[model samples]
Target chain A: MSNALSVKNLNVSYLGNVALTNVSFQVDEGALVGIIGPNGAGKSTLIKAMMGLIPSETGKVEILGKPIRKTRKEIAYVPQRNDIDWDFPIHVIDAVMIGTYPHLGLFKRPKKQEREWAYQCLERVGMQDYGKRQIGELSGGQQQRVFLARALAQNADIFFLDEPFVGVDVSSENTIMQILKELQKEGKTTLVVHHDLSKANVYFDELILLNKELIAKGEVTDVLEVNTIQKAYGNPLAFMKNEIGVKQA
Target chain B: MNFIEAIIHYEFLQKALITSVMVGIICGVIGCFIILRGMALMGDAISHAVLPGVAISYMLGINFFFGAVITGVLTAIGIGFVSQNSRLKNDTAIGILFTFAFAAGIILITFMKSSTDLYHILFGNVLAVRPSDMWVTLVIGILVIAGVYFFYKELLVTSFDPTMASAYGLSTKLVHYLLMTMLTMVTVASLQTVGIVLVVAMLITPAATAYLLTDRLWVMIYLASGFGVVASVIGLYFSFMYNLSSGATIVLVSTLLFITVFLFSPRHGFIRKVIKSRKRASLAN
Candidate 1:
């Protein structure tokens, strides 16, 4: 089977300070991979670099054996919830409908069917009733659900979510994970930049452990060992271990 | 006769009225985007920065629009470059670049000793507008409004969430520059009616009023355009009857409209919120 995403020698920097260095990773089809690391360890930066949201100094990114740009319509990215100005004057439905905009060329508006499809995506995320509400009025979890609805509306082959679970309520978390699993079943590849190390083990199929460099990339069961977690986190895994132990219990 | 008869009788009055309405509509439409994007200061900066372009065009005996547009775009790029490349914020970049351009304009006007009246450019004389100026404004107004209509969705996404715009393969940079260019055009086009001193008001007040009244972008645009035209017409009428300054009167009218909306708009106005809170307090008692 062809690889869903392939990254080679990816390097990124900000103001002469290196963020990611010589990072290489690849994901096979229909895999749910989590990229986890310590704070400021370039987990977000790696997602941005792979999505071409930021310019990489030296790297190559290919999606399903083709350049990423040619398949833009086949990819969806949901940035962190805080990345948006929620108070912007947009209705929730209008925000979700923007997902369909990439498939349109200049001068083409979203048709009625596309609008209905956006409503359906919102339904999938249980946000159909709040479609008329302003984005600012929604809670953090609802805001996140709206973002997921937007990504779903894109109908993409590959999905990238950066810190999707941060600040989300428990029910919203379950809703998102359920939708992501459904996407995987549909043969879509999902890469998530996760922050919670405890949930990382249980949530992802594969893992890319990093601390400004790729430490391990394999099945979660193999990569979640104490030694590997210590290498990525730069400390003993006492906090993570306690949380994981509680979760397992 | 009455005001209606005077408008029908005087060709100059008709021209002034037509020019005011067109300028009002264009500025109001474009202003919605400017204020929504929090680029109100950028609007003020670009409007003032076009002074040097006008001065240079007068000295070169060329159409002022060409010089004004070029200078406006350069000012935008300069502000963008300074903000992006340095640690300075956007406000600092706008202040530095606009003042530099404005100073250059004042110096050029003094040095060249051009015959064009600087006072009229600084504080516009809508009554003195020539037919050619009216035509130029019309063409620019149509082009800009059409551009906004055609690229509405692209502009919406890019302005609301640029990161998503990029992830979905829209070039955020190109959209930004395109908006800057349109802003430059609208600034230049409105110069003849509102002048640089109050162009920012013409661009912001009516839109701000509409913003208070509506939750939808299209409705905001529609309401703002209507408010703009009404303000301009009323202002022109008052200027005609009272022998006052047209630009200043138009700005004053729009400001008055905004104040009304601020106090009384049903959705987001201060008075409405206050009233609702008072009712809730009484009900609790």
Candidate 2:
């Protein structure tokens, strides 16, 4: 497969707690990869480690065939719902504008073009009317959409979404999946820490199963077997992932 | 209020007004972040920590503002670094630093044999504020507000969704430190009159009350500044008329506003409204 992202021997920890260890995986360009694992299995940590948000003990993460540190312009992120304080005072448009911060560089603020692009991103997410609204007033699904809009505005070649589908209705999910598929066509790869095996066939082309380390990774058709699922969530015979995992049925 | 008479007769009041406005705008700008991140109490801790810096600086015969600024920045950085590095809860860290700093300040004050301009430094004689300090606050406020607005997008996204922000290659830590630095500067600038003890009220109350009113950051900034201006005028009058401590009175007045909004604000308080709304919906249905 055409490679868009590559990780090797990745290890990350927080406050002395080991979250991910010796993790390695790859994402093909234009591929929609779903990351599946049990709660605290290092799905979120893996993404954070890639972005250098969490200090990685040992690892190399390359995005678009370059190290993540230098290739930031080509990547974007969508955090979980609980990761943000909804009570924060900001408009949806302002939230979307953050996706362009790196592009603006330090000390320089978002300009008019950036503002318009943020507005356009909100429109793409079906939140045009909500651009001026406070972020807290929106529903959970609406908030998720706003975050998606932010990622869209980033205009990156790759996107890292923690969980972009919780509280979303079926129609909204379809809309988001459509956008993801469209992004693939434009050579924009996406990796989602997704939960909801019910729609794995429709939403993901590849699956990365991790539990402290990579349990499995490859096309969904081969990697999502009953045994693999069991091993990925070995704590219980059947247990879902944690809040860090995206619920995307 | 004639032009010539206004300049000379009301010169002291004029200087006080100008100083208060500058402080209000700075607080409003930086307070926006403090309220958004739930770090309201942390502002209080850092402002109080400046007390010791002031004492030390006075003892060393340096500009008091120099000590105040040094302590404010150091306190902010220490809080940021420790919180980021360790498992210590924010409230505990703030409490530990704030109490010790204030205590050290009081000890220094006790031992000083020379006349101490403690009141001038703490409560602030607005009439005595030099033009240079006024200019510094104005420039700092402008720069800070510009930074806040410029990085508006990054700040908003990071504050709202750190996981997403980090994933997008936006360093939430960088934005966090930026916001804290701005808050520290604003706290230092506002120290002119609000004093260390209650300067935090100036930082938190206006924004908190504005939070009860609106959800948008732009609206929040405007409303918070408006509330700050109102509280300042009212607090000053109350202080001047009744001979109360200006700083303490201003803080109390702000607290009163916060309580009133907490109980009666229409959108924020859902628990009380739920019962009423349920009854109304049932009657209508």
Candidate 3:
């Protein structure tokens, strides 16, 4: 299988303080990968740098064998929940329509086909009924689902989600994970920044453990070893409990 | 003479009326984006910072529009530079640069001994608006409106979620600077109607009122522009009838509209929310 994403020697600094240092990893095509880390591990920073949303000290990121600038249409990114202003006076469907902007470019408005496709994306995420509703009127889980619908509307090959599960309900979490798995089966690559270690093993096919640097990158079994977990988290006790839970399941 | 007859009979009044309405429309349209992007203070800053440019233009016998736009854009870039390079926040930078430009303008005007011109620029006398000033406002009004109409999507996406906008390879910085340029033009165009001191009110109040009345950006823009026109027309009438400061009267009318929406808007109003909760409580009882 070919690699859908390749990162080499990625470094990022926030206000002169080092956020990520010498980090590098590759994501195989159609693979469902989770980025696991402790607090302040630069998980979000790494993804931001890869997308070129922020200035990176040094790095190279290629999507589908092309630089990000050349292949932007094939990529979709969902930033953290708090990164958005929930009360920005936008309808649910209009927010989804924003996903089409990468393809629409400039001057041309979203036509009937684009609008129908946006509605279909909402239906896939079970938010079809909320098209006319204000974005801020929804619950946390519904908001996350709406955002996922927006990403789905992009119809991209590689998806980057930053903490999509944070503040989300169990049903919404399951819905999001199910959609992500479906995307993978369709030969798309997805990288998720996940906070819940208990579900990391079950949720992802591969794991990239990080702590200001790349600690491990391999199958879940290889990356979740005691030594590796300890290196990344400093204390494996909490992770060990989750590990036992995973084993029992 | 009554306001309408005066407008019909006197060309100066006609120019004042047209100029005031155009200012209303442009300020309303641009103000929606400004408030959405949380740049209302930037509106105030640019409006004040243009004073020095106006004074310089008067001294050089050139059009004040050129001078005002240059100083306004400079102040905007200066604020962005200071906040980006240092720990000082945006508001601090805005406060520092705007006041400096405004004080410099006052000194220049004093040196030129143009106290009456200073009064008109600061307080705005629409009755004294010249034909040239009227034409300039009309041209700027068309440009500002066309800019918003053509770039609505770009402005919407960037203002709503800049991170997402940038991730999609859209140049948020470019859009921001473009909006800033439009804002400077709008501020300069408004000088003949609202002047510098109350121009921010025209830029923010009508848009804020519209914000409370809609859930979509396009709707907000339309409603804001409508509210701006209503306020300008009515304020002009009151100013002419009562012999008051035209700029101050227009700003007050816009503020009154905002207060009315704040208290009574159907969906997002303070009073409506309170009434709904009270009804729910009564039903429980």
Candidate 4:
């Protein structure tokens, strides 16, 4: 009952071609878990399936010990940057206000309190001054911060972010990490689909290493060892190690 | 001797003017969503697909509005089903369905005999708009505007980011279908003023021009509606004076405005980019 997330025997496919197979894991409340894998490893697919964003033939996902539909508002997800149309005609404030929309229900516009709250969320991401600017005009880093601000505005207990660091500046990465840590301190559970192997060790308390199937899952130190990484990434590490001759040294 | 004073003498001119402006506002408002979602082709597809509905309605001796709305929604759904269920892409689905419907319409028109000119439905004659046609446009115009006002944020969030929209329990799929229905309604409403061949242009051009001019979506919608009204009025004027096709004239005017914005928009236009780049080059020197 205390678990923030639980997945059992989850299987997903696209047009009968299996994308994920028998993925199972559980995370306690307030845990910072990283879902890491190689490209085409269903890293995004797994999180999406658990969140019921994609249909699964057979699976069970419990959020905060309740069915996903019942607790939908308690969960927030940020898709990959590339998944969004950056040229969309909207302002930063407009983008952030979307976070408050689900709660506003249909037929009601965002009020003054919601506007101030959206602005406060922007301030948390250091984007308060950029509120009036068009979203498309923002840099990659600033755009990611805007998404973070939106997620902050959602005020959800469980967060799912897919590659929040991809194509972003180093400072933005640091800022996102800081925000994730802050979310953890607030006892919010976060699951980030991260692709960067180098940062995995420092970024997560628990790592779910996957390559279409779960290769390893547990504490970062336990799951991100050389063997587990090699298992998930395959023989590339051997080539990388020989080429660099550094990890072996 | 003035154009407005002269036109006021004729009831047909007044009806045409009212119908054109109503179509303008509806198409303009809904067109903003179509443009923002990059569903212009969908708008085109629905517009083209409604032809058979008009013909069928003529054959049934019923109001073409109901028939057109039914056919438009059906075609939209069929397009969605094909794109989602099969390997065929969206444009391919749209192409297959709209053309088939259009061809069926052409064939059906050969069989049906009525006062409704097939030519007018194909290329609208706004001057020929009857009082009933004007009333249809009025009702549909009010419905489309009210829909946008009520569901503004849902459409905004869903169009911008469906992932986030669904995460927030907005039912992105439902929102999408709602938008398609709205598009169909707009296309059906515009059938009298722009005709099927030119309805998509009315739906896309004014909104695109507005996009080039503004960053905020509400402002874009308002500007697009303004542009739509302007184009309709001027196009009506020219069509009245020169005896040109009203639908084509309206579409052409909107296109001209879009091109002007594309070339000269201070924020995102080609000329602005050129000016900024030239300044940077001079600074480098």
Candidate 5:
């Protein structure tokens, strides 16, 4: 019923070129929200700015009615898969353990309790068996699942995933979506930067359409309208009509 | 005297052995993070940049460690500033700044007309390592080792994924600068054993060898340090026996170890991949 994340007048630029402009939206607690846009639509940039991963030119991000800095521990973010160096020497479980870092802080080591919780998080994603495998050794879907397990281990109130399904397989995608739905049922807010428009309506309780700015933000049916999709994507998607039940104008 | 007897009887040999081993351990530890972060070139840059600092310290009648660390950190910041401010890539920045610093060092040393000290500084003579320098290396070894152990999590996260680290409110830049400071100290400590030119070898080769041998980071750290010690001990023996340069010999030994592991490591080795694919081809028949 209450807003879990609120971004007001967000503006971001890359090398003096605008990446995102005047983007603003609010995500309610216990909702799975999908951000959909064309390529280079600044979907990832929007999420990064909200998480304060990259500097935003002008914006205000509040999580749980507090500034992001004060509520950092309550937010979990899984960056795009390509942003990671797959060959880095780390075990699946150890990578998942990094999710506990926000809770562990500087000097404290992860105790047995934290380790068990990390393992449990892995179990939640059905990746408990792959704990000892090298992260790079896994298939793309398994790698994404492992990352999702790590974010689950964070125990954060809100989750943001950037293009999680980009290279993922169907089974892992289903597994990830199921886990995300479970998180929503547990009253956690989740915002996913999704590339597949076909699954957008099914996966998210709400949708935020973006194209360097906020085009639409509301229920799936409302935001997936033909006019809004054309505005954000710059073309009428003939395939989207059947996909989302969008009546052609 | 034989090597063991020399080590037992001569205090200079004892100092050299201890100092070289300490350098080995710390370089091995720090080098794991360095290579993992793909900053091996940065390692090389910091090591060379210390030359001007060493020259300045000699002129000032002070310990070169202080001067070397200051310059190393400065070079790091300078590289960062250049690459961030300009269109030049990170390697370009490193190359520009380190060469300038190294050239400045050569000119300073030339002005001092101390070719003998320059030879030892350029090509380290661990045999001539002083007791005070030995103590400095030991202290630095402890500090570097302790710093890594205490900040292992932070380093792991930042090196593995900076975006996640920053999102978690861990200051990735702070960790980077902190690692650079530790690297400067390690380079300064290694000067009497490996010298600036060869120190990056000690930092990278042993860790890379360990990388081929393990998938887990902690295992790699331990194995890398173990390889570093083995190379130091054997290299010192060979250098002492053959009347060769200690720094060059040590670097060569680490390189040999890397080659051996590259060929034979069980999981990620060249030979193993060849054998497995050959077996798979035969199985198809």
Candidate 6:
């Protein structure tokens, strides 16, 4: 089977500061991979580099075994909510409909069927009532739901999401995970830049731990051992040896 | 004279009415993008900046539309350049360019000292609407509306969520350039009716008023165009009655409309709140 996404020697820079160095990873079809690291660990940069959202200095990224330049429409991207301006005049439904632009082709407005599809995507993420609400009116968690709805509306085979669960409520977080599980069941590949180590283990089928580089990759249980977790996160059982371990997350 | 006989008596008034209405339609349609992109003041800046371009074009005996379009595009490109190349903020660059261009226009107007219809340059000559000016605006207006419709979604998406648009393979840079080009055309086209000083009022006030009345972008566009037309007609009437500059009168009407909307909008206005409170008190009693 072809890889859903492949990255090699992916390094990125920002203002003369090295953000990511010598990173390599690949996602198999139907995989839910979580990339976790501390602040400034370039987890977001890896996603940006892979999605071609930010130009990479040196690296190669392929989507569905084809270069990003050629296969740009085959992938979907969900940036962190804060990455976009909430005060923009667009309503939630319109924002979700934009996900179809890549497939809609230039100068082609979304037809009635496409709009209904957007409505269904909103219903999928519990944003049905918010179809006409301006994005500025949504809460952080609700905005994340809108972003997820947008990605779902894309109907792409591979999805790249940067920090989808950040600042989300427990209920919203679980809903997002359930959505991701459904995507995996549908044979879609999802690469998420996750932060909370607690849910990272339970949520992701495969975990790619990183600290500005590819530190470890494999099954979450195998690669998330205390020592490796410490190496990747600068912590070993730091939240362990307690009854509520990973519970306060 | 009977009422119908009085209606078609004045040819200049009829010409003013026609010229100002066309200018209103073009500005209202194209100004929607300017308002959405928060580049409302850009129209004022470039309108004034075209002064030197116009004078030079006149010296060479070329079409002033060519000069206005060239200068307007150049000014917009300069702002685009600064926004991309430097850390300087967009409004700061706007302020810088706004001053330099307006000053250049003022200096040029003083130096030209030509009797070739200075009223048309400074305060707009709606009554002096020539056939060539009408033809230029009609062609350009059609082109602008068509361009906007072609990229309607792309421009809307980019204006609303630039990052999401770009991520989805839509080039926000290209959209930005297209918007700037449209604005340049709109400003140059409106020069004959609104003049440079009042162009911002024409470009921003209608949209802002319509923005207060509706949350739907499409509806806002429609309402704004209507408001612009109404304001122009009212202004033309006043200009004919009181011997005032039609452009200034139109801007004043637009300002009054803004005040009305700002003070009485149902959602956020104080008067609306007061009325709602009174009604609620009566219901409780």
Q: Is candidate 1 or candidate 6 better by TM-score?
A: 1
* Alpha-carbon shift of residue B281 in model 4 (angstroms): 3.6
Q: Which stretches of candidate 6 lie over 4 Å from their true place?
A: A137-139, A232-237, A240-249, B1-7, B115-119, B268-285
The TM-score, computed over Cα atoms with residue i paired to residue i, of candidate 5 is 0.98
Query: Model 5 over residues A139-159: C-alpha lDDT tens digits?
Result: 999999999999999999999
Reference interface contacts recovered per candidate: 0.84, 0.80, 0.75, 0.86, 0.91, 0.41
Q: Give the per-residue lDDT digits (tens) of candidate 1, residues A35-154.
A: 988899899999888888888999999998898888777888898988898867789999999988888777899989889999999999999999999898999899999999999988
lDDT of candidate 3 over B1-285, digit per residue (tens):
777788889888888899988999999999999999999999999999999999899889999999999988898999999999889999999999999999998998898796888998988898899999998998889999888888898999999888888888889988988898899999888887888899999999999999999999999999999999999988888888899999989989999999999999999999999999999999999
Model 4, range B103-149, lDDT digits (tens) per residue? 98888887886446888888899988899989888988898888889
Interface RMSD of 3: 0.9
TM-score of chain A of 3: 0.96
Among residues 3 or more apart in sequence or in different chains, the pairs in candidate 1 whose N, CA or C atoms overlap within 3 Å are: none
Ranking the candidates on lDDT from highest down gives 5, 3, 1, 4, 6, 2
TM-score of chain B of 2: 0.82
Best by DockQ: 5
Task: Write down the C-alpha DockQ for each prediction.
Answer: 0.75, 0.55, 0.80, 0.79, 0.89, 0.49
Candidate 2 CAPRI assessment class: medium
Cα displacement (Å) at residue A72, model 5: 1.6
Which scores greater on lDDT, model 2 or model 5?
A: 5
TM-score of each: 0.95, 0.87, 0.97, 0.96, 0.98, 0.90
TM-score, chain B, predicted structure 4: 0.96
Candidate structures ordered by DockQ, highest first: 5, 3, 4, 1, 2, 6
Chain A fold similarity by TM-score, each prediction? 0.96, 0.90, 0.96, 0.94, 0.97, 0.93
Return the clash pairs for model 2, or none. A77-B168, A79-B164
Best by lDDT: 5
Q: What DockQ results for candidate 3?
A: 0.80
Error of 1 at B171 (Å): 1.7
Q: Which whole-number lDDT from 0 to 100 does residue B282 have in model 2? A: 100
